[model samples]
Target: MSGHSWLLKLPLGKCKSTFNLEKAVCNHGFFMMAPNRWIPSSKILQRPLRLADNTTSVTVLISHPPDSSFLCVQVYHSQTPSPADQRAILKQVTRMLRLTMRDETIVTKFQSICPEAKDINFGRIFVRPLSLKMLSSASSFAIAGKRKRAKSEKLTTHEANNAAPMGNFPNFEELVNIDESCFLEKFKPILGYRAEYILELVEAVKTGRVSFQDLENSTEEQLCYEQVYQNLAKIKGFGHFTCANVLMCMGHYEIVPADTETLRHIRQVHGMKNCNKKTMEEEVRKLYDKYAPFQCLAYWMELLDRYEYKVGKLSELSSSRYHLISSVLFQEDTSNK
Candidate 1:
């Protein structure tokens, strides 16, 4: 599509809208979803967005608000997304908008102060992988013997392509190795006492005690963070942490996945003391203020660490080590799949 500069809307008060399609294809190039900010890349133009769960996915249609309106678009990025990335994308968009408009206002945090400025320039953006390597790398402590380099070393885009293999991402189940008991064990301590309970529940479905197709068909029966949270809450073993971890492991069956280090970063940077849904949502908005578009994964990781650190679990582990472990593990598992 040709640039529709005049079609772009100007900033108004607290107005944000999300389109189902990828924002890069939208006229503005900068996806304008209120309260969330995602700057689109020129290299890639469009992507699909799934809405109403997996029942429907569409190429998003973003329009200039009928009246005087401010717009922002949030897009879901995944190896393969099934609508669970909303919170992460929201956070990223918020951060990107904040960074792009940072100089514009002191009072208006996320809302743009410059409503009249026709063209705003926000830089290149991409999502950070939540699999083990980046997190483990961020948490690693083996730097004692190595000399410090003046510049940071990043994975070459080519290496990243080999490791991550962009485009459609793998679903959660496909990404994890079920045969590795040790893998389960690494996540077990973090799973808390409710581990056995969740495992039984998953086994029931996997073993056909509960029909998989039936459960996936039934909105209420399908296992995921929200459903599992409600189901496991009825039992005694599943506390908040346990339930959250189990939800993370369920893969495509359910997703409430966020890790410990990311959560810690959110708490430290955003000053959130509790992990209540509202507070978490607010933090998501704040993250959108900094890291638009790719902020979803960034938000998830930061919040994961925040939750873990607040509960004193993630702090003990070397941040980069965990990131490296997760990175290598995620890569190994995903690549083979």
Candidate 2:
């Protein structure tokens, strides 16, 4: 069994009308659970059958269950191996893919594609829920110091107890409630709203006893968007843009998250007239089956929307990005294996 690793490109052309990249990789020989779509691994492996005359690329992508890292693997091959060998190589590739996809950087990169996502700030987004003890011993180093640890060496606390410092454990709301001044004092060199503003907003709420309900109850006239966002920013150490983002975190915004481009195209180009929330959701889910559960679905939708807005038809958007990726399929010799 000779072995080598390299990044591979996706092979084009297939006949299946509903060709699913995510399902093809994630399923258990078409006999497993309904494949929940997501990005196929960024890194993949390809093994060629000695008798077959085809090239293959196996790409894999995974997301954490709620608060886990994103995993991606992309494998390319210039040959097609026998069915038995292909299965064996796939098992090995998946094992490594699982580990590499868990890298914090990979997770952040994946989330960054979400339409609602503003940025990927490790300290503010994923590592702020650390307990004092856990922070000092585990999380503090990740957020404060300059030491390099293995990618897998994360700072997570026990689930049952506030035992260890964890990374990306805190939800968006929790991130907004950290101590701003204290965080700034500890990590002065850091310069961003998340690291700085999130803490400030949290402190303001605590100091003023402003529960989440208060933010929601306030009227459009009583607390205009600009006013509310500005108030959030003025908290000691918070910036203007950061405060606006915090308000959204507090459930004040109507931002729908997905890969905007594909969604937009599905409607505009695909002749989806008067697409409502439910329609969008269903279509988005279907595309997720096609594209996998990518956070960038919003991007795909947005591109379609823009195309229709400009050309008065979805054809422009259809001919390129969305159409190409969504339509093609590969006919592997499942009959042999």
Candidate 3:
């Protein structure tokens, strides 16, 4: 990609577009997911957006009209960007700001299908693992083959390798294990199995063994959901929970993925104990069956409620103490009033 400049217009107003800025960005799950190492501003979300081709990532700014009739985007680069650069940026932009060119039907359909319609932004769709556009002076920009130094202390080789850039991941021996160890050592307290699950998907996408783009663009004639599900299921570490999460984030919510967290949630929210997988699946389906294909979204929001998190802006959680974040959520506050 070369370095160049252009103003991409989101044609919403000419078509009566009402893109609520806050509702739009908060739905991406990026804000709630500080653990992923991507950070964003409250009003204007800026992060490093990796090109689909994975050659390099560029930092971009996202803002809109006062009425937010259209989304205005300007991609910044160190050099002139190639045609591929613009296309890649546009694809990412489309995925991140799903309301850029949408019609009223999109919101209508989303609200009707989502179980907890009042809690989520019906008009927005989020990309799995999410996309970020880096800002100047961000420490992550140096996380490639060369690692970034912490202001307090010099990082070891293991830390350096584990934080290696996506492109440099393949160079590491057993890329999967490197990701696993990073989670175990650095992020294990909060992430638990989720680190391995997301890392599995990330490594697969980064290395070209699993292509998010290919699956996204495949026509039903080219590849059906069953075939896609089977292919994802074959990945060494992705079981039902991980596969459903990846697929649901990709916009397929036919089935809601349930795990121990869900069982605990049922105990808290619905007083169900000893819920078996079969029974659990049946219960979730019946509960959100009216929403039909969007049961997963319903299930996800309800689980979020159990964690005492509403669908809204995110706050930073200290890495060392993150394991205790959830504990604070459901714990009763019986301090003297």
User: How close to the true structure is residue 336 of candidate 1, measured as C-alpha lDDT?
Assistant: 39
lDDT of 3 by residue, 221-320 (tens): 3454556667678776778887777666555665667876565565556756555566887766667677755666666656654443521233233235
lDDT of 1 at 219: 30
What local lDDT score does residue 230 receive in model 3, on the 0 to 100 scale?
77
- Residues 134-186 of candidate 2 have per-residue lDDT tens digits of 21222212233232333212212331121121121222233343454666776
Tens-digit lDDT string for candidate 1 (98-125): 3223212321321232221112222112
lDDT of 2 at 215: 43
State which candidate has the highest lDDT: 3
Residue 193 of model 3: what lDDT?
72
Candidates sorted by TM-score, best first = 3, 1, 2
Error of 3 at 124 (Å): 3.0
Q: Identify the runs in model 2 with alpha carbons over 4 angstroms from their true place.
A: 1-166, 170-182, 192-199, 216-300, 303-337
Model 1 spans > 4 angstroms off: 1-172, 175-177, 189-198, 208-237, 240-337
Q: Write the number of the candidate with greater lDDT, choosing between 1 and 3.
A: 3
Candidate 3 weakest lDDT stretch, 10 residues: 164-173
Candidates ranked by lDDT: 3, 1, 2
Report the number of the highest-TM-score candidate: 3
